[model samples]
Target: MRIAFYGSSLLSSYWNGAATYYRGLLSQLAKRGHQITFYEPDAFDRQQHRDIDPPDWCTVKVYPATDEGVRSVIAEAALADVVVKASGVGVYDDVLLLGLQEAARPGAIRMFCDVDAPATLAELRAHHDHPMHRVLPELDLVITYGGGPPVISAYEGFGAPLCVPIYNALDPETHHPVPPDDRFRADLSFLGNRLPDREARVDTFFLDAAARLPERSFLIGGNGWETKAMPANVRHIGHVYTRDHNAFNTSSMAVLNIARDSMASVGYSPATRVFEACGAGACLITDSWVGLEMFLKENEEVLVARDGVEVAEHIRTLTPERAREIGEAGRARILKEHTYERRGAELDRLLRNVAAAKRERSAA
Candidate 1:
């Protein structure tokens, strides 16, 4: 089937959180014989910061940020069997989304792929005038990256006939274990940008733990983190490239996960790093979330840390053998349930089922 993806960043994730996902999902779909064309707006320096190039499995097209971009996206998606509009690309993408919804011909499924569940719902509820308001019913399907149960209920509550989750998946070829370097080696490390909402959590979970473990070494790798003053022990290595993620994960005894404000509040989205860290065979330590266990076993595959004290306790007590055991368990679980191939297969089934139902309705 022909599928077109319109998302935040199709080939780049430099400052974007959705890159690894695009690469993994699209690549898997491509391998599965689904023709894919990823259309992204050349906005927010995204073109300049391309992290992973589109593989041979799919085509990548960049459109303008202006009104002209919609025409270009429509032209490319004219005959797609599926058309998806993903959230948070920073483009004035409402224009593009509305255009796709209008231009979609029969047989093509048009979707609103909401990566941030609670945030999207909040925006839609707070202001029905928001771009997504009128188009809720026009979409053929709605999918989210996270938000186990509550998310789907909320979207359905808003009148979506069909809603599903296309959770994050790992690409083992890219996110596997490797020898660590001194730069990223730490008792604990976190890699994420500075968002105002997530900053407080970072302070409470990561910085607080770093402060408590003043005698131990810590590392931070990501963009938008230069302005904050850090404890001398916390080494801030501005931005770690896609190439370095494995080394960073392998170096740390345990990698920390700090959920974005919306995800934490909604309670289900685990960052790609969680899967990547575990796929790379690195032990994971995540901030307490309502449904963390649904993704990975709590205190078994993943260590849940509610405060700085808990974070310190986990790190101090973890032995290398235990870390390896936990990492192996996580890797097995991800392969069984969280790899990109697995996610793509699930989506394939969902798409087929939806398509079948649509056909039956049309015949009636």
Candidate 2:
């Protein structure tokens, strides 16, 4: 099958959240003998920090984010059996979104994959400020990377015909435990970009824990953190490349998972880092969430941190043997339940199903 992916930066994940998601999903789809022509806007820094170069197996076409872009994208999308207009492309043009909706006019199975389900839900619930409200009803299927219940309910409430949460899964070939690099080595490490909403949670769960444990080495990685000062004990490593992520996980005594306010509120959204970290056999200390047990066993595979006290105990008390056990269990869970191959298989089935449905409607 031919698939065209339009949304987010497919080539660059340097500081982008969806970069790994795009790379993993597309590469898996490619492995299944599907032809992919990924369309990314030229305006973003993705061109500057292209992570995975377009491989020989697929076509990666870059277009500008402009009036001309819509026409070009529409032209390219026509070649696909399925075209996915992914959410959070960092574009402000609703018209182009509408255009992508229309380009699926005759036969192609079009979809709006909402990676930011919690954010979309928050905005849609608001009903006025967000752009997604106007676009949801017309979309054929709304797919999400996170937000299991709250997101689906909200989308269906808004009159969406079908909505699904794909969730985040691992790609084992791409993510696995490796020797720790000196650059990422630390007692406890946190990697994520800063935003107005996420910063507070980071402070409550991460920074406060760092302050309480000045003796333990802590590290922070991600962009937009240059201005943020921390105790001298907390090492600010700026941005760690995606390639270095496994080493970062392996090097740490434990990796910290800080949920963005949106994901925490919605409860089912665990970031790619969560899977990536665990896949590397890293002991994880994360903020409490509702559906986390479905992924990791609390106080076993992962430590649950409700406050600075839990964080301190995870750092100060858990012995190496215990930590290794936790890491191994987490790794086992990821390998069994969430991997790129599994995700690819799931996606493969999904696309085939959606395609079949499209065919049935056409026949009808």
The global C-alpha lDDT for each of the candidates, from Candidate 1 onward, is 0.84, 0.82
* lDDT digits (tens) for residues 159-271 of candidate 2: 67788877788888778989878988788999999988799988888888899998889999998889987888898887677778899899988999999888898898888
What is the C-alpha lDDT profile of model 1 across 82-127, one tens digit per residue?
9888888687667776888877777778888887788889888899
* Model 1 lDDT, residue 147, Cα: 90
RMSD of 2: 1.6
TM-score per candidate, chains pooled: 0.96, 0.95
lDDT of candidate 1?
0.84
Per-candidate RMSD, Å:
1.5, 1.6
What candidate 2 gets wrong by more than 4 Å, as runs, is: 129-131
